[model samples]
Target: MDNKPLSFKGLRLLVVDDDPDTRKLISILFELDGAEVLTATSASEALEIILCFQPDVLICDICLPDEDGYSLLRKVKRLDIEQGRITRAIALSAYVMDEDRQYAYLAGYQKYLHKPINLDELAKAVNDLAQLQQYA
Candidate 1:
């Protein structure tokens, strides 16, 4: 494991989760890593934020009160594609089944993470995805 701190300076991130504690924890983690973090409790709120926030990455839970993460990822993909933007997304969920992982990939997530999440791994994954985007 890399002990170097994740550098997310100037990057914008959106974290969507119905659980307030989850949201706060993730937000603090990213913020501490130097990313500007935004939180949304539902898919609808996330979609609305995406329009203006134009985040570099989205970390979202699969389950929500309004809509599922898969649906939200689809919409975000479509919107970003049409707008000519590259916004990578990660599926952060409690569903760790093989089928769930497959479905998440099919739904267009760049990464899949299961809760309770390992913050170090999450940082590494996000950093890796951001690096990929830079090359893309």
Candidate 2:
């Protein structure tokens, strides 16, 4: 086995999705890229982890139990500003409407991913978000 660590080693990723399968799959995907991944099944759960983990990147589904992804995104941005922390975010959903994508970006997501997502795209998003953090 190669002893070298993966590119994302030590990076923290928080994935918020109400679907267990989706959450697990994304967590595994990020882990494979060497990130420490945290999964939440609801927006409230995600908020809790966001406060505690202070993840390097957030991958969030647009639909959630208590609130939608846009609401969650707003909460995250408010939390970061209140606490003086800056974090990058990616919005993931199956919506795929022009307005949906626009809403995500307007709510502060740096990038958007349509669901039934490609593993390669997810990996690249994580890497890109991490790189963005370095420059932010």
Best by lDDT: 1
List all candidate RMSDs to the true structure: 1.3, 3.6
Q: What digit string (tens of lDDT, one per residue) describes model 2 on residues 16-86?
A: 98888988888887787678999998899999999889998999999888999899989999999998888
lDDT of each: 0.91, 0.87
- Regions of model 2 farther than 4 Å from truth: 1-6
lDDT of model 2, residue 123: 80
lDDT of residue 41 for candidate 2: 86
- Quote each prediction's TM-score: 0.94, 0.92
Tell me how candidate 1 scores on lDDT: 0.91
Candidate 1 — which residues are off by over 4 angstroms? 1-4
The 10-residue segment of model 2 with minimum total lDDT is 1-10
